[model samples]
Target: MTNKHSERRVVVIGGGIVGASIAWRIAARGQRVTLIDKGEPGSGASSHSFAWINAGAKEPIGYHNLNRRSLEMWPRFATALGEDVGLRWGGKVSWETDPVAAEQLQARVQQLQSWGYPSRQVSAQELAELEPALEIGPVVAAEYSENEGQVEPQMVVDACIRRMSELESLILTGAEVIDFDRDADGGIRAVQTDSGDFEADTVVLAAGTDTTTLAAMSNVYIPQAESPGVVIRTTPLPPLLHNVPVVYAPPLGDGRREIHLRQCADGRFMIGEGDQESLAEDDTQSHADDLLSRAAQYLPGLAEAKAIPVPVGWRPMPLDGYPTLGYTTETPNLYIALTHSGVTLAPVISQLAALEICEDVRADAVLTPYRPERFATLTEEQVAEMAHPRAGHR
Candidate 1:
C-alpha cells in the first residue's frame, strides 16, 4: 500500500500535546484533519506537565526502549515544526539519600546501562561540579544520564497546532466531544461534539484523563487509574541550577519528599514534589510553599522565589501503569492514545498513530503489548484492582 494518507477525514479529540502532535502529523500526510478541544490548546494536562523528557527511571525493557526511541525523535520533530519549543538536551541527574534506596537506585542505573542506555553513577563531588548552583545534600549514591532532556510542553503543543493550521487542519477550541455516531457495522461515522457533529473517516481519542469516559461511550473499555499530580512554577528567577534537570529522592520518612526541579529556557524554575501526602487540605499556596521549601534544600536560590499560578492536572495512566494505544477491535475506525508521559511520547506516538490511521495498516508488532484489547474482557472491579495503590504521579 502507498504511504499517502490523502483525503482521509481524520478528527482528533483533545488539543493537548499528544492530540496536537497527531493532528499535525496527519495533516502533514495530506489528511483532512480536524482537532477538537474543550479548552485552548495545551491548557489541559499539557500546561501542568512536568515536561521532563527522559527515559531514565522508566521500568520494563519495552517501555524504556519506547521512551528512548521517542527521545531520539524529539529533535527532528521540533525541527520539522520549525518553532522554539524550549527543547533542551542538557541531560539529568538523580540521587537518593537513604542507603537502601541508594543501592536500589544504583542497581537500576546499572541495569539501564546493561540495556544500552547512557546512564552512569556519579559522586556527590561530580554532581556538585555538574550543577554548581545545587546545594549537595547527603547522597548515598547518584546517577547521571547525558541522554535525558526537557521541553516547554505548552510551547510544543502550540507549535504543533500552529503547524497543523498551516497544513490546513481545522482546529476547534472550546468544542467538547460528547459522543460518537456509529455506522451500522459499528465503525465511527462522525464525532458528536457540543458544538456540532463532524463526519470523519477515523476518530482518534487522545483525551487525557477523560479518555476512559469517551471510550465507554463507544462501548469500549479502556481502564485508567486516578493519578492526580501537582506542579509548582516559580516566577522567573536567575539561573539556579545548570541546564540539566535534578531529581532528589530524600530519605524515606513520614514527612520526607521526592523533589524534581528544572529550569526553563526563560529562567523560570519548575519545581514539584512527589506523593500527595504533602498536598494541603484546601490551600494551593500552602502546597506551593511546601514545594518551594523542598526545592530550596537543593537550590538555595528558590528560598526567595515567588510562586506563580500553575494549574494542577491529573495524569491519564492506564490501569496497569502503561500506555493503552492502538484501536479497538469492535470500533475499527476509532483509535485510542492514552498515556502518562504525553510530553515524552508525543512525537513517536503521533507519527505511528498517523501511519496506522492513514495507511490502514496494523502496527501490532510495535504496539501489541499496549493495545486496548488487553483489557477488553475485564470487569469494572478487576480493572480498578489493576490501578497502583499509590495512584498518583508519573
Candidate 2:
C-alpha cells in the first residue's frame, strides 16, 4: 500500500444514501473505492424513508447548526451529482390543536428563531394562506419553517451510482461482507465479501442499523437503538399540497400522534405518524389505510387516495441520540458514518467524510464532538438515560 491518500484503496460497507454519498464523494476525490451492499443499493432503509430534509426539529444549538449546514449544502450536492434527485425547497408547515401542544410548538419555534433558523410562528389564516389545500381544523398555533424541505433518497442514491459509474468505482450489490482481513496491528487490511475481496487502506461503516454490528468487528463500539418507523404511501394524486412540499398536521380521531405527509416527485404521497425517529413496527395494509384516513382529516384531497403500505424502516440512531462519525481510536483506518437524519445530512457529512479519508486528517472542528470514542466509556445507566428519546429533528 502507498502513503499517498488518493492512491489508497477504500471500501465502503453499505449502499444506502449515506454510504453511497460518501463513496461517491471519495471516488470523486481520486480514490480507488469499492462499495459493497448486502442488498441492492438504496433498496433497504433508504427506500422506506420519508426523506424529509430539515433542521427545525434538531435541538441543542450545535446539532441544529450541523443539520442547518447540511440542509444548505443539499442543492450544490444535487448539482455535483449531475442529477435532479427530486430536491425541493418550499419548506414545511406544522400546527397543533391542543393548547399545551400549541405552546410547546410556539416555544420551539421561538427557540429556533433565536438560533437564526428560518422558523416563525404563523397565524391560522397565514397557515391556510401558505397551503390553501389544507382543511386545517382548529389550529391553536402554527409555525412555518420556510427553509425546511424534502428530497427523494432513492433518487439521490441512483444519482450517486450514475456519478460513481463515471468515476469508475466498483459497486457490488447483493454482496454481503463475510469477514475482514486485518493487519498485524489489528487494523483493516481488506474487506471480504461474498462477491470477492477488496484491499482496503480505509473502510467506512455506514451500514445504517447494521453499523453497530459491523463496527464491533473492527473493535469499535457503536451502539444503536431499535427505531422502526412506517411511512405509508398513497396512490398518485394531482399535486395534493399546493405550496409546501412537506406537511405535519395534527392527528385526528383517536390518534395519539401527529401525521406528517409529503408528496413525492413521482406523484405518490408519503404519510407517517410521529416524527422522524418515531418507533413503530406495524407495516400492515390496515395500518397504512389508518394513517391515510388520519391524514385526510387535515388534507381532504387525500380522501380519494388509496393507501400503500411501506415496510418498517429502522433508523440508524446512536444510543445517545447523536451522530457517531470520524475514525475510531481502536482502528484508525476505519471510519464510521452513522446518523439518523441521513437524508438531511448526506451532503455535508459526505464532503467531510471524504476530506478526512482522502487527506488522512480529522475534521476536528466539526466532528470532534461526534467521534466514535464518545461511547467507549458510557455506563449502562447512562445508556438507558439517553436511549433514543423521541425522533430527531423536523
Candidate 3:
C-alpha cells in the first residue's frame, strides 16, 4: 500500500442506490469518483424494495426532521437529473386493530404532532373515504401523514447513474472488490478488484447485504441480521385507491399478515410484507402467494387483480434496528452505510457521507448517532461466543 494523498480519487464499492447517490454527491464537489459493482447497476436489493418513503414509523422529532429534509432534497435530484425516478408524493396510512394498539398509535400521532408534522387520527369513515374498496377488517382508527410518499426504487438508482455519467464519473459494472489495502499511515490507498487495482484516497463500502463480507476483508466486523421482505405487484387496475394505506401488523382476525398496498402510477398495485427471516446467505425466495393472499384480504378489489410478479430481497438489519454509517475505527478513509430504510434515507445519507469526505466534517446532527464504530465495543469472536457457548470447553 502506498500513500493515498498522492491521488484525489474516491472508490465507491457498491453501484446500488447508496453508492450511486454518494458518487453523484462527491462528483458535485469536483472530486474524481469511480463506482464499482459486481453486477449490473441498480439490480441489487435497491431494485427489490418497495421504495416506500416512510414517515409514520420514524418517530422522535429528530428522525422525522431527517425524513422531511430528505423529502425536500429528493425532488431536486429528480428534476435536475432529468429523469422521472417514478417519485410520487402520495401520503401514507398506518392503521391497526386491537384497542390497546390503537392507543399506542394515538400516542405516536401525538408525538408527530409535537414534531409539527401534520399527522392526524382518522375515523373509520375517513379511512373508507380514502379507500372505498379497502376492506378495513376491524381497523376503525388510523394515522395519516400527508407528506409521506413512494417511488419506483430502480428508477431512482437509474437516475443517479445517469447523473453520474453526465458528470464523467467512471462506473464499472461486474467489478468485484476483493480487498482493501491501507497505507502505512492507515489511510485507504487502493481497492483490489478481480480485474485490477483501483487507487483511491477514500473508500465507501455501501454494499447492502454484502457489507459484512466486505468488512471482513478489512478486518472490520459489522453484525448484520438479514430480514427477508416480500413484494408483489398486481395486474393493472383502474385508479381505485388514491392514497397508499400502510396497515401495521395483524390484519384483524383474517389470519393474514399486515402490509401496505398502493396503486402504482402505471395503474398496478404493489404490496409488501417484512415478516420472513433467513439464516443462510443467498436465501432469496418470493413469498408471493402469502403476500397476495393477505393483501387480497385487505383490499377485496385485489381478488380480481391477477398476480403479475413477485420480488424478494434482504434488508440488512443491525441490532437495535439502527444502521451502521460513517467511518470505522478499524480503518481510516474507509466508510460504511448500511440501513433497513436505505431507499428513504439514501439521498441524505449519501450527501452526508460525501460531505464528510470532501469537507472533513459531517455537519448533519441526525447522522451523529449512526456512526459505524457504535459496534466497536464488541468483537466478532465475542459475538460468536455469545451466540454459541463453548460446548466442550471445561
Instruction: Using TM-score, give the best candidate's number.
Output: 2
Residue-wise C-alpha lDDT for candidate 2, range 299-374, written one tens digit per residue: 8988999999888888888886788889888887889999988999999899999998898777899888789999
lDDT of 3: 0.72
TM match of model 2 to true structure:
0.96
Tens digits of per-residue lDDT for model 3, 254-291: 56446667767677877765322222222233455556
TM-score ranking of the models: 2, 1, 3
lDDT values, one for every candidate: 0.82, 0.88, 0.72
Which stretches in model 1 have alpha-carbon errors above 4 Å? Answer: 1-5, 249-254, 275-283, 309-311, 379-381, 390-394
The candidate with the higher TM-score, 1 or 3, is 1
Model 3, position 273: C-alpha lDDT score = 56
Candidate 1 lDDT score at position 54: 79
lDDT rank order: 2, 1, 3
Encode model 1's per-residue lDDT on 98-182: one tens digit a residue. Answer: 7887898889888999999998999989988888888877888998898888899888888888888788789999998999999
Task: Record all residue pairs in model 3 with backbone atoms less than 3 Å apart, i.e. clashing.
Answer: none
Winning model by lDDT: 2
